[model samples]
Target: MSLIIIGSVAFDAIETPFGKTDKIVGGAATYASLAASYFCKNVKIVGVVGEDFHQNDIDTLNQHGIDTTGLQIKAGEKSFFWSGKYHNDMNSRDTLVTELNVLADFDPILPESYQDCEYLMLGNLAPQTQQTVIKRLKNRPKLIVLDTMNFWMDVALNDLLETLKLVDVLTINDEEARQLSGEYSLVKAAKKILTLGPKYLIIKKGEHGALLFHEDQVFSTPALPLAEVFDPTGAGDTFAGGFIGYLAKVGTINFNNMKNAIVFGSALASFCVEKFGTERIINLTEEEIAARVKEFVKLSSFNIA
Candidate 1:
């Protein structure tokens, strides 16, 4: 079975307090696929890039054991590119540039081989595009996790709501959760969103950690504190990848399994912020990942009377 991820695979120029970069491989799919590859061996990607996207970049993804058979390369067009600068807080940033070249008209076409998908990670993309991927798949995946943002809620709200009906899990930040549910309290928000669609909801809290909600059950995990956060870009996408990747590896769906998945996801996301773009995650080792996951365990571990 394959763990398929669909989203943007393109270039990014970033400037943080620690350093700056010209153009690096940084997109929702790029980060998520890389994070998932560490846990799920049969990881695949579905995305489009233009002539400007170097072949070396595609090779990099392949080197990580990611199947790029579904990746489309269009000629005579520039790949999607984004540039952003982070503030000292590292949590906030300003978009310096956004060129949605080939991605402007991206029509996700799932290859026949991708029909074996058991786990699907829908990275941040337009609500309509996300819906199209679900409709195109011959068979529904065992697990379908959708990652979205406030942008979609502001523009294509109805489409996003409809897409929610097709996904089993939904991942969004604290702010987005509030915006989507129109409730200030996260508990209330989770209830409202759950009613709308997804059986499970994950509200990402950045440096603070993440929360997992299903029915009347809720699990909260604290974020691993880091000395320095070089670049916050793609951390959420990386988390989503690890979350679904771990789930795919376990080959099961339950509240307990989801809790363990969040720890692995947070561990992967912790590594993502240590450097710019995908620099840190691309070179992670088994030992390093295990150590990080252990650290997460210690953060919330304790004895009860």
Candidate 2:
């Protein structure tokens, strides 16, 4: 099975309760591609960067078996840049700067070769851009997962709602859920969002963990607590990567299968927060991942008598 990820490839300057990074290779696609590559051999990335973006980053993706032919490099302009400062809890951050640069006018052009993808992950982006990618797919993927943020909810709620109709699963944090659904309660928000179109809704609660809701059923997983969280950047995209990558590896999208995907995702994300950017995911060995998954099994496993 082939998986396609469409989102950011940019630079970020971040400050967290743990420490700070002046400039680092980050963004949605970087994290998602790295995490997903651990499980899927054929991961196609679709995004845009500029001259200043490092070529080694492209090589990093390619070395991990992520096809980056779909990634565009705008010759003269600078890449997108974001700066943020996290609060003491590291659960939320305040934006300090947002320079779209080359990404400001991005019109994603998916390569013809990426047309047959079986799983599609649309990471955070403008609603219209995400919708365009979906409409261009020649055949509908088995699962189309979407992630968005409050920025879109504030600026383009109507377009965001329209795009939600095309996805099978939607992943957003608890705050974004409340913003999108205008409901204080997550249960009510999930119920409201499900009616919009997606069959599954994941409400990410950062350090608190994540929750999955399908129909009337719900599953919750806890985030791994670490002594240090060097950088909180890209953790969410890492979660998405692991979640979708596991599903692709198993070649199934059923509810039972998705449960495993969630656990895999949570485990991968746990590794992400331990370091800055994609450092942890890059050099991680398969044996280590297997061991972590076993740990997840132990933490969540229970026998009903």
Best by TM-score: 1
* lDDT tens per residue, model 1, 188-250: 999999998899999999989999999999999999999888889999999999999999999
**In model 2, where do residues sit more than 4 Å from their true spots?**
none
Weakest 10 consecutive residues of candidate 1 by summed lDDT: 225-234
lDDT of 2: 0.92
Q: Please list the C-alpha lDDT of all candidates, in the order they appear.
A: 0.94, 0.92
Backbone clashes, each candidate: 0, 0
TM-score, one value per model:
0.99, 0.97
The residue-by-residue lDDT of candidate 2 on 186-268, one tens digit each, is 99999999999899999999878899999999999888767777778899999999999999999977889998898899889
Per-model C-alpha RMSD: 0.7, 1.2
